[model samples]
Target chain A: MPENSVICLKNIHKSFGDLKVLKGIDLQAHEHDVISIIGSSGSGKSTFLRCINLLETPTEGEIWITGEKLKLARNKKGDLDASDPRQLAAMRARVGFVFQNFNLWPHKTLLENIIEGPTQVLGKSKDEAIAYAEQLLRRVGLEERKDFYPSQISGGQQQRVAITRTLAMDPQLILFDEPTSALDPELVGEVLGVMRDLAGEGRTMLIVTHEMQFAREVSNKVMFLHQGQVEEFGHPDQVFGNPTSERCREFISSVY
Target chain B: MFDLKGFGDQLLAGTMVTIELALASLVVGLCLAILAATARLSDNWFARNIALAYTSVIRGIPELLTVLIIYFGSATAIMAVARLFGYDEYIEISPFVAGVIALGLTFGAYASEVFRGAIIAIPKGQREAGLTIGMSPLKIFWRITLPQVWRLALPGLGNLFLVLLKDTALISVVGLHDLMRKTTEAVSYSKEPFLFYSAAAFIYLALTILTMVFIHFMEKRNSRWGDK
Candidate 1:
């Protein structure tokens, strides 16, 4: 792994009993790098993104964030360490994750949803959290919709709010699990636009997306995942323009 | 052989008692229900097991048996405690208190399931969002979980309340002057069982209708927040 890498996953393996999902995967993301992961459905792309945030615990291997090793402490028997509640909580706080379904609290307004993390996790005062919430909502072009519930907003708007909710934590890294896949075709552009803007501001992002055009336009590097392994990874042009691996060429052609 | 004046007084008094019993028990039952549901979902095995035991025992027996047991059993227990505390003389447990305890216990058992379902129905992500926002578990339960639970559990709670209202008649067996007891008393004096019983039935029907209207209003108000 590079010394300045923001995230590093080495020899990571995950499985669901009889079915293995991620097999000996090694990947690294540098600071402010927009890395898009593209793969066919059931290709373990979502699982990979989830593993980065520890939403799904990997069966084996290690994840390092900003140079800090995320290791499961084992007993004398060398069994996998089952994380205690406190450790799991601390790990979750550093990585902000946006779900594909825009899992906004249905009971809270957009403004409340954005303010929740800062007040709850960071223990910010209510007044300060509200002030920050307003600023973030405005940045997402959701100032007018602050009082609206999640059900009242469009999918694009909800996704933006979800992003702002994560940003409230001021996390060092952000993970997007098929962020725009659940959106309507027309709404997809608005969410992708917001993501592109975030990329422009040099935010470190790992996005799982099937949108080839989006991958080409926003990502500094694009990784094509095939059957739980990285088949090809490089600058968007190198990977998208002239494919080296047969698998990569076949995958890109199929999508096109 | 109808004693109109006596019937009027008894029926009015009974109606008042019925309302009081239902309202008091409803408040107490709901409070206990929330506690019981929280305990059922608690991390500690002792608390969860205790809550489970309470629900199971109460649900297993018939309502009449429960009412009788609480009425007599609590009176004995209270007197025993009083005796231990040096009040050796008779400590009468009032019929009103016994009725409240019995009905409240019954309502609480059903309400526990209602509360549990509501709490479980909420998406886990909502709680995660609550934690991420810096709300302590207590604040999260009150602000995020409880409000949504109330909305989701309203219909079930309404039904429970209606059942509880009807169950107030059970208190008549304990010498409480609720609708059923008063009706029986009026019927005996007036020698007109049909008329007084029919009147009591009408009153129950009216109360049920009023309660349904209130429930409808609540559902509408709560749903408005999420509606576009």
Candidate 2:
């Protein structure tokens, strides 16, 4: 309810054909907050991240992005859809999403992939988008690989490019869905390093991750979700070092 | 003996006509294939069923029969429509137009299946990436979906193009003066079936070889990313 809140979810609920995945969850993200969502595999972590952008439309809830509430109504398909498509698209533009598998468009080069979202969606000129893309690629130590296909690069490098691609949009919020889960154990560290840099820059990010160490070190606030509800949420030290809920304690002990 | 000097000009002209017919039908067939594939994959029940029926009926019949039906059958239907409008000046379709329509319809039916498979092969996350970036649906198709589909469909579509090229010979039966018809007329006049028909066969082979070269070049250029 504060003025600085960038994302607010009130009573978020999602179900798939009688199977309720996310149940009545409420969370608020303020400016420059790096919130880490950690949970077991089937605890609706990925689905919750997708719902933030209406990728998997929430069955019942109101999602406010930077204080603008999304308009939703039931369509003939008996699923909730946005009443105004243009508004929905505009809302989506305000947030960025990074996938687990690093879904870079294979036909285009790294530079082209990075510039696509900024030029195509943000209405930035090609020259401007290219310049920004080059800077971001350089930051990720990938300026030399700008012309390479995603398949030609290592999985870690591909994920870095995926992050740069999302960063080029300059979105208010960046939602990461298991960004390093698909990478090999050796490659996971490189991706986590890049994310640590972003968190240092005070970016508003919500990452659904299984990396317990990264969650503790990189995020200011950590949320422990269990069975589609927040079991514990507080500062990283309090939640991880001293979890209040029995389930949270059990999850942390099992993982660590 | 061969009348190379005298009828060489006619053969060349017929070859040009055949190339033009093939290109026109290709353009028409591409449009038809895109429309048909979209309909087949779409959510509309009526559109899907209509597209399914079209592809099934066209694929079931022989290409030659489809050409015949499009040529004579369309003429009959058009004449009936003209009579209803009280215009009886004997409106007839040009042979070139009829050949293009007939051959193009058959090419489209076959190409639709290739396109459908290509579209299905693309990962769902590609579209989600586009949507997250706020690209319009039409823009997404042109930018994201089209390039991948073209890459995936190239070899299959290249094969279909060859089949479409050879099918132009069937148009000669409707008297479009294509490569085969020119060869037939030249044979009748010269009485040297061996030389004239053999020359025509060589010309068809040359055409195929040249087109294959272009297709081969395109395949090489586009496959660079797949090298790894």
Candidate 2 segments exceeding 4 Å error: B1-5
- Give every prediction's interface RMSD: 3.0, 1.4
lDDT of 2 by residue, B32-149 (tens): 9989998999999999999999999999998888888888888889999998999786766777899899888888999999999999999999888888877777888899998988
| Residue range A1-256, candidate 2, lDDT tens digits | 8345899988889888888899988889999999999999899989988888878888888888898888899867565678888888888888988999988898999999989988887889999999999999999999999999988999999999999998998888899999999999999999999999998898999999999999999998999999899899999999989999999999999999
Tens digits of per-residue lDDT for model 1, B71-119: 8888788889998888877666777888888889888989999999999
lDDT per model vs. reference:
0.84, 0.89
RMSD of 1: 4.0
Best-matching candidate per lDDT: 2
Q: Classify candidate 1 by CAPRI docking class.
A: acceptable
Candidate number achieving the greatest TM-score relative to the actual structure: 2
Docking class of 2: medium
